[model samples]
Structure formats: structure tokens, C-alpha cells
Target: MTFREGCWRRRLRGEWFPGTRLTLRALASELGTSVQPVRDAIGKLTVERVLVLRPNYSVQIPNIDRELMDEIFAIRNLLEAEAARRCVSVMTDADIDDLEEAILATRRVYWVESEIPSRVTTIQGVSRILAERCGSEALCEQLINLRARTAPYYAAALARSDDGEDAEFVTFTIRIQDEFVTALRRRDEVAAAEIRKVDLYTFQHYIYRLLDVE
Candidate 1:
């Protein structure tokens, strides 16, 4: 991708910042490129469900219903905790090391004043690897789709905090993920399952607050 194209995609993914409604021209100007690349990138992201195109051709970062958002995360918890638990017997030393590395990387970025999308991407990247290593292809795909369904959930949470994601939320998430890793290291299936559920519900809680359901 052109630097301009890459930057535009990054913004759409909320890598640099949370985005609202943005016109193609405005995005093009910021990227310092012509409108063509912006248009192409926008089209691509829309297909990825990363951007929603309005009737007037303006693009928006997705905003989803809070109830549905929470439900997706719950599904993710159910699918992925089982996957991780199952994968334990099959996990090699290298796989364990990689998981440890991902955990550390997540901790490093947890409190950084970076954009939420980038942070979300980092979390998901490691998770995808962990999920895929599980013996079940079907479970892996389900977890991936579940994660993707949370795109709007992440967007809404980032926006709701207004000043950006609070240190408390970040720290809580890092701690939860670490507990999950600990469970994995110990081959404690029940503990792993519980920690994963906490991560899922805590994420749901953010949306619940937004919907005033909590």
C-alpha cells in the first residue's frame, strides 16, 4: 500500500485515533494523497466491515447495538477458552514462549497513549495464534469471527471513555490476560475457562454502561 493508503487504513481501523464520520476528501487531504487511493482504501475497509458507508457516501466507524455487542463477546469467551484448554496438551515449548511474548507485548502497550484500534489489534493478533493452534479448525474460525464482531464494541468503548481508555481499564485487561496465561502455564483448565469468561464479561460491561444496562 502507498504510505497515504496505509495511513488512511490505519485511521479507519482507529489505529492512530478513534474516528467518527469522515468524508473522502477530508481523509484524502490528511493523507496528502489524491482522492483515488482514499476511495479505494475506503472501499476495501468497507468490505472488511471496518468502515460503514453512508447513503451520502460519507464513511463512518461502526457503532453497533450494545446488547448484540456483549453477546458476541460472550460467544468468543465460550469458544476460545475451550480452545486454549484443549490446546494445552499439544502446545510446544516454542508456542508457550510465543504466548509469553505476546503477553509481555500487551503489557507494554496497555497504558500507552496510543489509539485503541492498534491496541486491539495487538491483543487479537496473539489471540488468533493461540486460538488457531487448538486442534479444532471450526473452533478457531468461530473465535476469529467472534473477535471481528467486536470491532464496533472496541470502537464504542474507546469513544465512551472520551479522554481515551482509562488506565484502570487497560490495567484490568492486562491483568486478566496475564491470569489466563498463568492458567495456561499451569494446565489448569477450569481456571483458564474462568479467566477467559472474566475478560469477556468485563468487555461486555463497558458496553453495558454505555447502554445504561448496568
Candidate 2:
């Protein structure tokens, strides 16, 4: 990948904090590259809304707000529901097995503060698998980009260490994932799509609560 793309990848993956003030020279020095590539990277991310250029000559992560969060969920619901619907007919025994494995991995990390990222990744693995099996590359690409944009918010939500709260979140996630796998196993496209929609909105609500935005 180009240095610019690599820089964009890191930012989207939540390597940078939400309010971090980034300068071209600083990033270039940190990435062990020239300022030109870093400048190019910042320009691209600024266009993507992943980064915003300030009047003060700095780049920063976009501050998440209610409107942005709602829009993200709306798009996710449409694309992910369709992906789940398409996957029902094509999913195999091995696909179900992989999803179960992902759930199991998530279960193992229950309530671990430091492992929240892994938990989020494991939960996401199911949909990623479904998207791959669904035969729609455009839909898959949109879902992936949406996930990258929202992953940091998910990580922040999952990192909550409130008493009994993380357990509840984990239980909620495992239950929905189990239901989704069961729908896939039955080849019930309608059920799979509906369940996936509920799952996405449910998690989105949880994250919204974590952000105190809803």
C-alpha cells in the first residue's frame, strides 16, 4: 500500500484519538516518511470525513454526534440486513462453524477490559463471513467501510467496566449471535435478515448510550 493509504488505514482503525490534533510534519516523522505522503494521506482522509481540516491548520478526527451516529446505523441496517438475507441461501456448515468459533472466542474474553477490541472483532467476524458468502462485493465493501468508521466508537462502548454491565452486554451479544447462526442454519433468509437488523440497531443503541448521545 502507499504510505498515504497506510496512514488512512491506521486512523480508520482507531489508532488515533477522536480529538487528536495532527500536523503533517509530526505524522511524517512518526511514520518515518516524508511530509508529502503524510500530507497526501491527511488530504484523502479529510475528503472521506475520517479527518477534518481545521481553520487553525490542523487535522483531527471528526467528533461523533447524534446525526452522524444515526446515519451510520441507518446505512448499516440496510446493507447488513441485505447481506444477511443473501447469505442464508449460500452459507455452509463450515460457515456456521466459523461463526460459532467467533462467538466462542468472544465468550472467552468476557468482561476483560483490555480485550474489548478482540471481542468487537470476534463479533464482527460473523457479519464479515456472511458478507463474503453473500456474493455482493459492493455491499461487502460498504459494510467494511462502515465498520471501520464506527469501530472506535464500538471499542469505546465495549471498554465500559461498569459493575455487571459488561456481562449484560456480552450476554446480549452472544444471544443475538446464536440466533443469527440458527437462522443461517435453517436457511431462513427472512429470519436471518430481521435478526441481523435487530442486532445492528441494538448494538448501535448501546453505543449511543455509551456516548451519551441518545
Candidate 3:
């Protein structure tokens, strides 16, 4: 990656706070490059929605808003569950195997002895893979957008100390995955939808509690 691209990536990873200003001159100074590269980087990130252009004619990091978070999760629940249900009827043996392997791998990557690791882009990656194979492109696209927006929260939750919540959190994930895979294998659309609803609600509750305590 170019220096400016690397910087923008780091900023997306929350190395820089939301609403951080990024002017061409300032970024050029930090990147030790000319303004052209900075402009290129800014343009790329703008397309990705990783950076937002402010009304005052400067670039700023995307800011977190509670309402937006809710809407994202709500749409995520609807589209993902529906798509997963649809996918089961058309799933090949290889698809089931891949889904199971991806979930198991994500379980290991996300939780280390019931403790969250410092960086967790892998879990998101795997989730995207699972969501991608769904029957509907529109559903997958919506899920991708929702997951991208909510990723930082998941990372934040992982970075939190396990404290006494380790067992509960791990168990929750295991239960959700079990229900999901079971419903898929059986082609039980109703069960799959219910499981997803429960999973999403439980997840929101956990995040709220964790963030509140922190």
C-alpha cells in the first residue's frame, strides 16, 4: 500500500478517532509524500465510506451514531436470516462443509481460551464468507454493508477483559452457531429465522452491557 493508503487503513482501524480531520497538506506532511498521493488516498477511502467529507470542505473519519447502529443491525437480521434460509434448499455438501469449517475456525480465532484477542479482522472475514454464499445477492450486499459498519463494535467487545463474562459469551456464540447450522441442515426456515432473531437480540444486549460497564 502507499503511505497514504496505509494511513487511511489504520485510521479505519480506529488508530485515529472519529471526526479526525485530514487535509491534503497535513496528510502529505505525515506521509512524507506529495499532495497527489494524499488526494488519491482520500478519494479511495471516500468511495469506500471509510472517510466522510465534511461540509466545511475537509475530510473526516466516519463518526459513530447510535441510531445508525440500530438500523444496521435490524436490516442485518432480516436479510441475513432470510438469505441463509433460502440457501439451505440449494446447498451442496461442500457448502455445508465449508460453512461448518468457517464457523469452527472463527470460533478459535475470535476467542482464545474464552478471551478475545487484540485484532479480530479474521472473524469478520469468515462471517462475510458465510454470508456471501447465500442465494440472494441483494441480501448479501445489505449484510456486507451492515457488518462493515458494525465491525468496530465487535472489535471493541473483543478487546474488553473477559472478567466473569467469558463463559457466557463463549456459550452464546456456540449456541448461535449450533442453532444456525442445525436449521440449515434440516432446511427449517422457521427455525432459522427464530434463531437469528434470538442471536441478534442477545448480541445487542451483550454489546450494550459491555460498553456500559466499560
Candidate 4:
């Protein structure tokens, strides 16, 4: 994979926490490449607001304070819910079946200590299906950008949770996914939107609680 794609995957898997800093030299060495490609990759991600360039020639994952968290989730709730609603009318039975299978895969990996990356990927797979089928390319692009921005924080939040809380959160996520698929299967756009809202709210609640304790 290219450096940018590798960086994005790492962020989504919570391999790096919010506010984590890195130098170009370090990234180049880690990727076994020269600094120029890493610099180019950083420039692109910086434009996407996925990475922040510093005056010291370092890059950092943008930190999420409570206020920023609220802002991000608020926009996410609006856009993601709308995407879910829009996709309902467009989704085929085959698409819904695929989503159900993905959710089942999520359940299997959520409890495995070594499968956190797979768990994250499965959840993202469900979201990608909705966004792509939402029938609005602009909305889909916006949702993807928003997801990239918040992914590190999501990973950080789960990393901070206790095992019991972690399991509970994963279970809650799986239940929400199931409900969303059900709504899609029924072509109930309103219910699909509302369920999407609830999923974002629950995630925001978990992150907010973690922030409070910190």
C-alpha cells in the first residue's frame, strides 16, 4: 500500500491515538521509504484534515476536546442519518443481505483480542455501503471525509475503555447495525435515519464519558 493508505488504515485501527505526533524521518523509516513520499502523503492527508502539519516539521493527529467531539458527532449524526435514510430506497435485497453478513462478521471479531482491526473494518464496511448507495456523491464524499476525521478519536475512546465497557460498546454497536439492516429491509427510511442517529449518539456518549474521566 501507499504511505497515505497505510497511514489512514493505522488511524482507523487506532494504532495511533489522538494528538499523537510523528516526524517525517520517523515515518519514512517506519515505512521503509524515503522522506519525499511520506511528505507527499502527509500533504494530502493534511488537506483532508486527517493530519495537522506543525511549525516544527512534525505531523499530529488532531486532538478531540469535548467541544470538538460534540461538533464532530453532531455533524456525523446529521449527515450519516441522512445517508442511511437515502440509501434505504436504493438498497437492493442483496445489499441488505451483504450488510447482515458483515454484521455477523463483526460479532465474531468483536470479542477477539487480536482482531480489533478486523472489527473496525467490518463496521466501516457497513457504513461504506450506506454512503455509496445514498445516491448523492457529494453526501457520500462528505461522510467519508467526516469518518476519516473522527476515526482516530473513536479508536482512542475504545482503547481507553475497560474490558467490560468495551464489550458492552461492541454489543451495542452490533445491535444498532442489526436494527439498521432491519429498517433497510423494510424500506422504512425514517426508522433507518433514527436508528443511525441513535448509533452516533451512543458512540458520542461513550467518548464523552471517557473524556470526563480523563
Candidate 5:
């Protein structure tokens, strides 16, 4: 992948923490390149709102607050729901198969290991598959960009939860995936879209609750 693509993926994967300070030289060293490519990548990401460039020329993942998080996730809810609605018409058997496999894989992790982090990783993987199957590159790109911007906060929310109680959240996540997959399999566009909205609704509420105590 190109440096820009690599940087984009890193953001979506929540590799950086919110408010983590960074410099061009540091990123170049980490990516094993000189300053120019890293500069270009950072410029692109800043333009895309995946990173914020300070007046001092340093960059950092934006410090997330309830308002910013709600705004970003609200956009995500709309874009992804529309994508899923569009995807239902174009989805193929192979795509369904892949989704089924993803569901099974997620279940394996949940049942055997009960790791919230792993379960969350797997759930996002399924989301990527759904986005690609939507057949609108523009929609997929927007969805990814929005997710990349919020990924740090997403991870932060997950991390702040106690491990002992995270299994319930993970289980809830898997159940939602099952609902989404069922809607996809039945080619029910309304159900699929509604599911996406419901998923976002619950998550937005969760984030609000998290912020309430902070």
C-alpha cells in the first residue's frame, strides 16, 4: 500500500490514542521512510479530518468529547445505513458466504476466549465486508473516513469499560451482527437499514453514558 493508504488504515484500526502528539519526523521513522512521504500522508489525512494539524506543525488525533463523538457517529449512522440499504440489491451469494464465515469466526472468539478486544476487531471486519459489498465506492470511502476519524474514541470507550463486564457488551455486539446478517440474507432492506440505525442508537447512548461520568 502507499504511505497514504497505510496511514489511513492505521487510523481506522485505532493505532493512535486520542490527543496523542505526533511529528513528521517521528511518523517517518516509524514508517521507515524519509520526511517527504510522511508529510504528504499527513497533509492528506489532515485534509480528510483523520488528523488535526496544530499551528506548530505537529499533528494529533483529535481529542474527542461527547459533542464531537456524537456528531461524527451521527454521520456514520446515516452513511452506513444508506450503504447497507443500497448493498441489499447488489449483494451476491459469495458475499453472503463471506459474511456467514465472519459470523462464525466471531462466535468462535466469543465462546472460546471471551475477549472483548478480539470480538470488537472481528465485528469491525464484518462491517468492512458489508461496506465493500455495498457497491458504492464513494459511500464506502465516506464511511471509512468517518470511522477513521472516530476510531480513537471508539477504542477509548471500549478500553474504559471494565474487563469483567465487557463480555456482555461483546455478546450484545454479536447478537446485533446476527440480526444484520439475517436481514441481509432475507434481502430485507428496511430491516437492514433499521438495524444499522438501532445499532448506532444504542452505541450513541452508550457513549453519552460514558461521557456523563467523565
Candidate 6:
């Protein structure tokens, strides 16, 4: 993979936390490449607003404050709901089956693992599958970018949660995913869209509360 693709994948995997500064030299060393590719990748991601370009010529993951969180979630909710609605018409049986399996895998990981980053990556992977079958390349790209931006925050929130809160969040997530799959199976567009919105809202609610307390 190219440097940009690798960087993007790492972002989606929640490998980089918010406010983490990155330098071309460090990235080059980590990836076993020269600084030129790292610089190019950083430049592209900065333009995409997935990374912040500092005046000092270093890059950082953009930190999420309450206002930023609200803005990102607002757009995510709208786009993801629309994606779900669109999928009702376009997604094949295989695609739906894949999504179901992804959800099951994520549930297993959430219950069995204490690793926040792995959990975040698996959760986002399900959304990635849904976005791909949304039947609009433009919509898929937007959703990917939005997900990349918010992944670290998702990881951070889970990391902060106690065992009880974490368990509750996991239960809520699996229940919503199950409801979503059922909606898709029935080809109920409205129900699918509404369930997706509920899922996003619940996610925002937890993250928002965590940000407020911090």
C-alpha cells in the first residue's frame, strides 16, 4: 500500500489518538520509508481535514471539543441514515449477510476483549461495509472521512468508561445492529434509517457525556 492508504487505514483503525503530533521523520522511521512519502501523505490527509498541519510543519490529529463533536455527529447521522435508506434498494443478499457477520464478530470482540483500539476498529469496519454498499461513491467517501475523524474519540470514550458502562454500551450497540439487520432484511427503508439514526444518537450521547466530564 501507498503511504497515504496506510495512513488512512491507521486513522480508521483508531491507532492515532487526538492531539497526537506526528513528524515526517517519525512516520518515515515507523513505516520504513523515506520522509518524502510521509510528507506527501501528511499533506493529502491535511487537505482532507483528517490531520491538522501545524505552523511548525508537523501534523497532528485534530482534537474534538464539544462543538466539533456536535458538528461531526450531525453530518454523520444525516449521511448514515441516508446510506441505510439507499442500501434498502441497492444492497445484495450477500452484502446484507456480510454485514450481519461483521456485526456478530464485533459483538464477540466487544464482550471478550478489553482492548479499546481493537474494539473501535471492528465497530468501524461494520460501518465501512455499510458505506460501501450505500450505492453512491460520493456518499461512501464522505462517510469514510467522517468515520476516520471520529474514530479516535470513540476509542477515547471506551477507554474512559468503567466496566459497567462499557458493558452497557456493548449491549446497546449489538441491539441496534440486530435491529438494523432485521430492518434491512424486511426491506423497511424507514425503519432501517431510523435505527441507524438511533445508533448514531446513542453513540454521540455517550461520547458527548464523556467530553463534558473531561
Candidate topping lDDT: 6
lDDT tens digits, residues 46-137, model 5? Answer: 99888889766688889866667768888888888898797788988788889779767855653465444454566466567767889999
Model 2, residue 210: what's the lDDT?
73
**Ranking of models by lDDT:** 6, 4, 5, 2, 1, 3
- Residues 155-191, candidate 4, lDDT per residue (tens digit)? 6665665667667777788788788888998999999
lDDT of 6 by residue, 163-206 (tens): 56667877888789899999999999999999999988887887
Best by TM-score: 6
How many residue pairs clash in all the candidates, one count each?
A: 0, 0, 0, 0, 0, 0
Ten contiguous residues minimizing lDDT sum, candidate 5: 110-119
Q: Model 5: which residue pairs collide?
A: none
Residue 33, model 5: Cα distance from true site in angstroms: 2.8
Model 3 C-alpha lDDT per residue in residues 1-214, reported as the tens digit of each score: 7865575446424355444576778778887888887777777668866667765446876555666667667877777667667767777768878877877876665455433322445455434665777766777766765665566566566566364675677678788978888987888878876776776667766765665632
Could you report the Cα RMSD, in angstroms, for every candidate shown? Answer: 5.0, 2.3, 4.2, 2.5, 2.8, 1.9
Span of ten consecutive residues with least summed lDDT in model 2: 8-17
TM-score comparison, 1 vs 3, better candidate: 3
lDDT of 2 by residue, 58-123 (tens): 787667667887888898898999998988777778877887787676566554445554656765
**Cα lDDT for residue 135, candidate 5:** 90
lDDT, candidates in the order shown: 0.67, 0.74, 0.65, 0.79, 0.75, 0.85
TM-score of each: 0.65, 0.87, 0.72, 0.85, 0.84, 0.91
Tell me the RMSD of model 5 versus the true structure: 2.8
